[model samples]
Target: MSRDIRIVTEAQLREVVSLDLETVDVIEAAFRALAGGGVVMPPILSMAIEEAHGEVDVKTAYVPGFDGFAIKVSPGFFDNPKIGLPSLNGLMILFSATTGLVETVFLDNGYLTDIRTAAAGAVAARHLAPSDVAVAGVIGTGLQARLQMQAAHLVRPFDRCLVWGRDPARAASCAADIAAATGAQAEVMTCPASLCEQSQLVVTTTPATEPILTAEMLHGGLHVTAMGSDQGGKNELAPQALARADLYACDRVSQCETLGELRAARAAGLMPDTPPELGEIITGMATGRTHDAQITICDLTGTGVQDTAIATHVAARLGGAGTVIPV
Candidate 1:
């Protein structure tokens, strides 16, 4: 191989890695890899600044059979919108699996993260949610909230979607954008409970410090995908909501215990009995929803396996575009 690293910008990556069914399949396979112990992943290195309302996380994993691994740095500053900036930004570095040489540097500025996360949500829904979803719901008006719905449609096409946000104006805007993009009727919901009552699949994408989706809001045949809590203090689902679910799975049990919704549930003395990992379900090691009325929950704390899988997929797509880098 020649000695030249391929540097991809966010715009370039947008041309390749889109939020579609293909990406969702890739993320699903990554979870299966995690379940089979085919990847070497470490706990996320996370830091939070309470005063600034910001957090930074570093995650990476090496799938032994894959050609490359990705180290991702993701930062979230909740105050950025006030300064006319996006709330999330970061990048990833791809290294060769064999030589550990830098093969690609994706200056995606969190675009890949956004793609993989949305795709992960869709994957979770595909495996855990009901086969036929009439109505979909999103809790939050942020980018992930919109992306989650878009991605979910790739698997279970919903008739319409409901969006709820603290700011009604933002929620309306979100509904408009989603409607324009997917040609689906979108409306602003008054509360999370109302949305849950009407929708079978609901995704929570808020950086909330308090629980947003509680047990009283959930009913039979409902599936919840909680993707917001990636740090210790961030939580979106009430402990009772999880404890009441028929099937409660997480991307990673270890990470969920410390950083995902499970952490909050445990702290509240509401731990579910023998919760399985989402990977286990993906790999068929565990059952997902056995009955139509069974309530299911998928806690996605964001995993390095997702980064590795996406980065590897992107690199393969860039086969002719990427130059060989020497060790």
Candidate 2:
């Protein structure tokens, strides 16, 4: 009998990063699949990720009714200078798609968390980014930043990429690394605001509490993906940026209103009453980009649908690699 099965560890995550070339495809496919219909996904619930100045804490629930585990690996604990550990640690407790029973568990928690997230970035680019988009701008230089940049390339090639990070040295170095990895000319931007000024497509992946992207910096026709504000109070987009968007889409409105970048805009009465859902847009129920010059924004709050999609994809790919032997 096929019992509850499958688990992936950290080493496997590293292996998949190198081994999986079709990762962005999986992500894009998932969105299309979601937009195509027939999948059921519950909302994700997460507590605030914060604490006293010296401490860090984050608790996230993958779905309502079905219990979930949020495993986060902290930063600043890396001993080695070159090969650092993942910032968020712990595996996801995946319940069965059919029965809501805890079927498979994965130990390579952050790695899976990341690629799926990056895939969402791919989804945003596919539906929103301009056909002529040739320059990609990314803020933040961490793992999430890397995945987003990589995923965007999978959707379409960029003539050049610009990066901005808190750490100048790391930013420049990471740009070089990405350039080498993707065959795209990449460099650290002289200023973070330059991202909005120069690039038509931009993504912000930082964990900033205050607004990092001001509307004053934005140019016309920029498609923005604000993915870092998965938790409440962690906002990356400024109100001006939201105001600048001609079309604003989100993974889910309920979650985005309560936590994501949409929260701030909603609080200020700047966001729309009926912003389109990403799924609806994908399904052709709604429009994505009506005009080429319209500014668009998509806020991602890490949903259970994406998690389950990744889990299912991983299981299919592994093909009994982690299946348990019968007793």
Candidate of highest lDDT? 1
Compared with the true structure, all predictions reach lDDT values of 0.91, 0.71
Reference-based lDDT, residue 186, model 2: 93
lDDT of 2 by residue, 125-230 (tens): 8888877778999998887787788888877678789999989998988798778767889989878787778887888999888999888877667888999987
Top candidate on TM-score is 1
TM-score of 1: 0.95
Error of 1 at 155 (Å): 0.4
lDDT, candidate 2, residue 82?
45
